[model samples]
Target: MEQIIERIDQLWQQFSGQAAADISKLPQSGSDRMYFRVKGAEDAVVNSAIATYNPHIKENETFLSFTESLKAAGAPVANVFAVNEEHDIYLQEDFGDRSLLNELEEKGFTADVFALFQQSLSKLAHLQIKGGENIDYSKCLTAREFGKQAILSDLLYFKYYFLDTLKFPYDKQALLDDFDALSTYLTHTENKHFMFRDFQSRNIMVKDGQVHFIDYQGGMLGALQYDVASMLWQARANLPEEWKNSLLEYYIGEVNKILPNPVDPVMFTIQYNGYVLIRLLQVLGAYGFRGFFQRKAQFLTSIPQALKNLSAFTGNRKMGIAVPEFDKCLQFCTSAEVMSRFEPLRADESTPLIVNIHSFSYKKGIPSDPTENGGGFVFDCRGIFNPGRFEEYKTQTGRDKAVKDFLEQRTAMPDFLNSVFDLVDISVAEYIRRGFASLQVNFGCTGGQHRSVYAADALARHLRNKFKVRVEVKHIEQEAKNWINP
Candidate 1:
């Protein structure tokens, strides 16, 4: 890999690269799979380089054909300039560094931002372009397998993290019963459009103040609401409930304008809520896996926020969907009786075990049943009581950065987190001794607000289901006080 990178640099310097144009400071960010940037003869080149090792799309003629098709369909994608199939390298146009996330945070959102988002949706609705004519949504794991795998992630999350990592053990029958109910709720839900899985703030780049989509490899024929839920319930760029509703309507309007058969807004909204729950589960597993196994901190922070947002949506009346099992899961999070079950996991040791059992002290009402109180849970077993252990992880700016990254990664945590949590559970059970476990699980954005509080509650509830001992969930910064009484 080092030699490849060096060789690429050498070739660029020899060919298209120029001394006058600095490529070193280009706004480059990516996953382990690929990375690239804009290269220029001077500093005025309109093209960029997209280097990758993804064999599926790298050497295949399908990628080039896909780009051509996208262009024909009037999609605002980067133009392919050059390709090195063997090495998975391609030079393309440089879209600006400004993301919808940056724009909304900096200048505050405007009609233009909304309009661009709408336009992107409009283009997506009529995505006549095909990367390959034989593409089947069912053949891929994303569509056919997504529904089952996604729901399973939530069960696994509740199993490992809440049960194993946090040492919350419960009766086997109850756990199975709980999961069965949840599974039934998830399976009965309807499906919708070919969704751009990560269609949210960060992926939707604003180049020249126009929205250009990226990170769309996971696209699938799925639910429209899932994408809508993702855009609105996204951790990093969370809009107010009112704004979220308006955006949903706006997206539906865009779809209606382009499609031959107009979609029923009410029906779309219902499906969207179900997708939101599925996405949340998938996100938790994704984040947990990334954080625990892959050493990606960004995934760690997203789990709480994603779960909280899902909890709120399940209970929200405007959603008009009854995700009963999801609501039950949320209710379990707030049950003091449930959280107390983690007491057995706590060890009597030199440093005291800090178990934080959570409740709805932040958001006033649960979205599942608007009149009912349904907040998520938080379980922090990290030994923060020790100053030395605490100091090791504390970094001022890094905390803020972590929070930001968490918000960004919110929609993709459940599946990742479940994988991580499962590994942690298996590993810990095999190796770590029964002793003090101190964890700090934060579940909020910009103070102890809606998403954070709800997630904290869910985490707590999940922990309770796993253990037969006592666990405490604390709202570190909330103005109000609400604790579940066993």
Candidate 2:
């Protein structure tokens, strides 16, 4: 890691003619590429850029070439500033920390967020049609085009990595025949467009309120519908059915404006549905390979969502192509029995831990243990200022607006919570990863009504918003009305 950091610094210096003021490593994604955020010297004209290092030279070359093509076609893509083919390190425009997926999570599915999705799809249509022009197919990482073989590869990816792993009953030879039929049916579509192989919300970054695309190293020439399908059918996005239909129409309309001739609505719908099925299955295979086989908990969390998508798709309508065995496989995969394997832990079911948080008066003793395990964390809040000592706030509990304001503005409660977050985050994260069943966190003070209550509520909100985990908050001294469950 030290050698890699030094090399990134060297690359930054070589590119900008001065050393970077700061170079920090970025988090790794599903890909093998290592990323870094490099800031130019304090006085330099270029302030910052994203540096990427991949061990594969050929893949880097393909990405560089594709990026240039997409940019030239007026797509919203980051520009490549420098390249070191020998070291397989390159620099590109930094799109910052926000992705469409992050935006959706922070600000739910609002009109403004949906507008961004519309703009992204409009730009995607342009990338598929205009970006394909004057591009060299020989530089592609896999097949030069998404042809019959490529379609089959995705179907088989679903079969071996996902279906077979489930131990579901199916006729192997019949499924293979169905796979060939499906591939043949899909490959006949208008496929000479630039296909962003893994185009999903996570790959679309929102910088300065505009969407910028990335992670197209696996892109190749393919049908236009495939990219659209990849985006709308993204497992975790969980886009509403109405939104999906409207977005599909919106994309088709954009394609009409870009293409010399418009597509037939009927034919387009048929092909689009076919691709959606293909993409959904392909992603389930990916989730299974990354989650079940590799034991990555993050990927495992997505399996249920993907299965839900498959269920919705298969239940609504049949694909135009006849593949009875394939349909049978889909039905089996989306069945209640198969899906239960990936379902979130129910109140009655065993697994995925729930955190129980309580606020209590130290004089009255700590909250009683509710789980089979006898011990848990108890944080003392006595070091913090007591808002209850003040006359105006004496009668009010932590949930009251005045008491909340006092704790936030006047006390060291924020600092105390930050320190507590630092400690508890480690355990909460590890517990979720290991599939532990329960965790109890308690905050105690002179009285339960003020400091302790405030701390418990704050921690519960933080855990739910950050980890999407179940947090139940209780104020022991308050009435039953003060209890919160989610």
Please name the candidate that would achieve the greatest TM-score relative to the true structure: 2
Clashes of each: 66, 0
Candidate 2 total steric clashes: 0
User: Each model's C-alpha lDDT?
Assistant: 0.51, 0.84
| lDDT for model 1 | 0.51
Compared with the true structure, what per-residue lDDT tens digits does model 2 show for residues 1-486? Answer: 557778888888788988888887776675678888999866667789999989989999899888888899888899888887484899899999899999988898899989999999999999888988967778999889899999999999888888999898899999999999989888887546989999999999998789999998799889999999999999888899988999999998999998887998778888889999999989988888876676544566688889999899988855688889888888899999998776643322443678999988888898889688657689999998888898988878888776786676567887788778767777877787778778999999997888898899888887775567888777887744444332
Highest lDDT among the candidates is held by which one?
2
> How do the residues 198-300 of candidate 1 rate in per-residue lDDT, one tens digit apiece?
7778877787757777665565555456666677777767667877777778878877776567778877776566667556655655665656566553455
- Work out candidate 2's RMSD over C-alphas: 11.1
